[model samples]
Target chain A: MTGGRGSGLARLSLNQKTTNRWSVAEAVQGCVRAGLPAIGLWREPVHEIGVLAAVQLVTDAGLRVSSLCRGGFLTDPTATGRQAALDDNRRAIDEAAALGTDCLVMVVGGLPTGSRDLPGARHSVVDGIAALVPYARERRVRLALEPMHPIFCADRGVLSTLSQALDIAECFAADEVGVVVDTFHVWWDPEVMTQIARATGRIASFQVCDWITPLPPDALLSRGIMGDGHIDFRGLRRAVEAANYLGDVEVEIFNADVWDADPDEVVATVTQRYLDVVLDG
Target chain B: MTGGRGSGLARLSLNQKTTNRWSVAEAVQGCVRAGLPAIGLWREPVHEIGVLAAVQLVTDAGLRVSSLCRGGFLTDPTATGRQAALDDNRRAIDEAAALGTDCLVMVVGGLPTGSRDLPGARHSVVDGIAALVPYARERRVRLALEPMHPIFCADRGVLSTLSQALDIAECFAADEVGVVVDTFHVWWDPEVMTQIARATGRIASFQVCDWITPLPPDALLSRGIMGDGHIDFRGLRRAVEAANYLGDVEVEIFNADVWDADPDEVVATVTQRYLDVVLDG
Candidate 1:
């Protein structure tokens, strides 16, 4: 039931979080079984199976690694805390390099514990990314700045707009620092289309997911599968394509319902929806 | 203990939603009892007593009508839907004028019923506002465009940033169209300070609330009382003031806990927190 299944499937990639219950090997196997060309890997599971072994498994399965889950929580307020975060981000860069994916998604962190200095925290994120750029550049791992939805600004990521992310990323070379165009996080931005145009060569990864309402108690798991929410998928996909992003179009959903469902069925639904709503109108 | 009680109380206006249990008479009485100089009225409660009587209630209490709750849900796809919304907004303009307030907070509606046309919906909002401007201008009511957090863009406000709101408001005279700087919605925005500075004469109403996490099941009730969450109140307050907004500072919280509390207790807490966090810093 892969509805519009032609060149679209070649562009399709399954993000690991969409099938949260699956192990790294299982996700890779699921991608292969569903005829997916690539798989977006998460840090925790890759660490569990060991990055080297995970890399070997994906390579043997002929699956390209679209991206490494995340590598930035650089908003810690203390000098020691920031130093430690930099050390961790360096390790993440090494992992992203090992995974054979140039894109290392950066979820720049929010305010420190009880502090409300949003501007100061944002400055810390920029400073932290600046510290990581040289290392990422040396490793050939492009740091993909993921500007999360404003809902996560206080606790998850203070970087709230694509324009804001570009302001930071543009400070470095496009290949060294790029932006992640995750539809779920950015579909609501009035400037999103224009920003996508502005991203041009700086789009490290273009991920798709839907924005559903009556958000779950845990707002972090609020993402819906494509076509299930109010986002105009084809519109965004065309904009990303126009931005010259010829990379894998990753399907990254974070809904509890999808997590609870069987992974195989979820992959099938994703593939069908990707074709029906994303690649085609 | 009215904490830091002098000049600050003069500037404090309690939004009616903060005391959801109160009637127009009760809210007005509560403001005077707390020595607060104003009350931000909501249309429902005002309509509950008839707009004229609600006006009399506040006027006799020597309370200023800081601003009207709302007057724009203009994203309906059909012409009739939009025309009806425009007509309703006209009544709202008349109400605001009768109530003797110049500011009418406009929460431009979300995506149409099941449509994913975000750009289309946003264009409708702009058209809707454009349609209302003449009437609002005649009635001396400023359409305070509220750029809600992106979380609400799909259902509450398509306008998601102070910059976007200003972009739309700048199309008309500053008095006819303006923006609402609600701390709960704009606190997380990286460009808030700069946008607030840009809002200069267009800062229609400055509303205060805290952004509490572990959001309640209903995201609409996610707002916290001042100092209960992560907003830098004094900073936003100073920014609004610097923008030459010489108006009442309204405290509008929709948290269930705040709504469930005794209205008097809530008013006292708001006054105290306003003095401690927003004014004194």
Candidate 2:
């Protein structure tokens, strides 16, 4: 059962699942065939297909670019590594600008190599974002900082909660730095709804996915498909929409099972499920 | 190549190696023989030897009871399940009171069964703890809320950040609630030091362990022994001690590999490691 009938379907956007199976062009075409309105493109896919070509393909497919998959890996204890990450983020900003995407999602880096200095890493993230803000603002590209789950605190992203991300966003001037509300990451957060309300106008992008049972060894890449796992997407959508986030609701799944399935089938199943449960709610 | 040459050897704790092979009595005797000052006791071992008996064994041996393994699983969506958890927690508080332990550790339950309502579960936890606080205070037993990693957000603990736990603790009067700072769980927190400072006098327990590479399926149970994982316990110890927490530095490990070893050997290794790293540093 959906969250009260007649709530209406939430918008559907496809995040190119982080697998090498489907090319960017193919994924965009698949979304079109499945009747999905938007797509969240990853950097590697765009890089592989060439930024100009990827942009052209999205434009041709008549699909909205919900977000650019990532932009930040800011935690580099060393100057060399830090500079490199900032430089890469600059490139991502350029790519997002080229694609005419809604925003560039940021997965702020976790602890620096060989160290447990969490605060140090976080400081670097704030600094990295601050340094990139001017350029991002100039290009009119929103930097959406996506707070990962605490499981990724060691090797992935240091910003592990919606409140933490919002704090970082608040440090930046308005509109330049925004927050990305991804259900897979923040669904378990106790303050998620409260933070979503606080994030109202600051929400650059919104993503949806499910949390599965029996966590994987590498949880960063083991998210569940929309209806296959246990998350109240309709409830989450209602919260976000209540906060006045009119941005596209992107489906970002990182599951081996779905990747192993037929790509077209995956798209079709997700679209139908989204329409039935989330949108129709 | 440790934290510093003068820092001395790494201090290891037996928690990283618990696979249910040792009894509480055996582990305590082993720690004393190995010259380790403190030992963390789990519930099953206490139950096996009987609470009073275990407490007597440790006390008579001059071994400090660092912190009770756990006491909270407060979130249960159903009234019966919630009451059952609180009832069990009451028993745990009584046991801690009898053990003369520093604090009763609480691993607050995650999302309620078959439900993805994280906030609801968290509220239940607060209510559950508020219910237990009076009983614990009456017994003069301090409650230390240990925030588990976000990976456990679905099935284990809803409170995933030290800040979140600290906030919950602050809800109660200062003396009634405190926190168990486990390096394995909080090492990746972006606000680790700041939150630690905020938790200064409120810090009830400080547990040390390691985070090994290539996490396994049961990541929680696969914790690394001190010095074997990535955590810098010496630095962490300094932070906690700096916070004015004048308590035993409990060596709490949950490693599958260490548990399979002989209990005596496990104790000996952990004791030596703890002396070499923690006390030496």
Candidate 3:
């Protein structure tokens, strides 16, 4: 079953964090074993094995790099803070270029600590992205703005809706800055479908996961596997497909249960669910 | 301090849920002691004391009923379920009328259990509200659609944005159906100010609560007092004020700490916060 290649498997990308325990090498091998043609890489794990070695390892395994985990957190209000964030993101862009993936998912930082200035924080995000655009464009890396769920607005990502992300992404060239349509983050948006349609060419990545309720105390780990929660993955998949988003459909689950499970077993489950719940459903 | 009346206190309304332990009579007395001119009523507490007596309690206290807590949960898929919800909402409208508050806050129910059909659930909400509008009009009650934070979209309220709520509310007469502008629910929205301006005279209740991070295990209890978290309450107040929302500014916190605190102290804190953080900040 692991060796059998299917058309749906080609579109499926095992996002590294989904199998949280797996190292970059382990994740790549798992993708190859599961017949997934692609794997999304996270910076920390990629850096663990060294970016050059990580790139060589994935290339040797014949796996496509679907996307890099992130490159944004640009909501700092201080000049020093903004510069540090930009410098780090430049490094992230270099990593994305080295890894041979144009897509660099961006989770813009939330409000500065002890600050009630939401508008100021959001303005900084736009300005930070503007500053990074030329560098990203030169590197041929796309800054995929991720509009996180509103639950993360205060602490994780200030970009709270796909429409809001698109508004910012539109300011730059489509190839320079794009948006991520992650079901876990955006499924509840009333305008999600409308925004997805509008995203068309600007959709850099389409991440799939379910939004489970009774959110654990740690909301960052609240995502469920596609079939385990309330998301209509097939509908979202179809919407993106219709939006001309012919890119990797990265399965990015952040649930503690998925992380705790054996990586091989988790990969098998993702494969089956991606086919059943996301593709064929 | 409780006996001292200030101009800021006149525009303030203590949403009963903020002091979760207070019964209808207790809340009215608390409002009076705080020198607050208005109080937002909850259906369960009103029913607990009998709506008519609760009305008399507030009336004799010389307090105004700013708005009724809720009259929604209308996203059921089954005919029986929908009918039961509609019936319940009609009773809620009656209760709102009896309480001498035209604004019946509507927390349009979330997706039905075991259902991933969010669009369908949202449709049911609109249909349900449409069915309730005529009855509400007859009772001289305004159905105030409360666009809860998107975090509650799956299990509590499908109406996740003020703009989305206004879309449905605008379909009905402005006097018959209106929308709520709750800071905790919408402070993250990039279009919040624009939507608030669009709402104009249709703003039924302008609720304030800060969006604190590290949300508790129960997301429902995530609200903080106006100054305790990241919301810019004064900006929101000014926006609503500019929009000509000459109604009560309700403080509707749901934090466990707030609930467990002495209700009088909480009331005092809310009053002081309303003046310093909300009115004068």
Rank by DockQ, descending? 3, 1, 2
Better of 1 and 2 by TM-score: 1
lDDT of 1 by residue, B98-183 (tens): 99999999999888889998888889989999999999998889999999988898888899899999999999999999999999
Candidate 3: regions farther than 4 A off: A2-5, B1-5
Chain A TM-scores, candidates in order: 0.97, 0.94, 0.97
After superposition, the stretches of candidate 2 with alpha carbons farther than 4 Å from their true spots are A1-10, A18-20, B1-19, B262-265, B272-280
Query: Quality of candidate 3's docking, in CAPRI categories?
Result: high
Tens-digit per-residue lDDT, B1-281, candidate 3:
53444765878999999999999888989888778889998888888879889978988999989999888999889999999999998889888888899999999888899999999999998889888888888988999999999899889999999999999999999999999999999999999999999999899999999987777778999899988888888888999999999889999998899999999999999888888899864
C-alpha lDDT score of every prediction, in listed order? 0.91, 0.79, 0.90
Compared with the true structure, what per-residue lDDT tens digits does model 2 show for residues A23-48? Answer: 99998888777667788899987898
Clash number for each model = 0, 22, 0
Please tell me which predicted candidate would have the highest DockQ against the true structure.
3
Instruction: Give me candidate 3's TM-score against the actual structure.
Output: 0.97
DockQ of each: 0.82, 0.54, 0.85
1 against 3, candidate with superior lDDT:
1
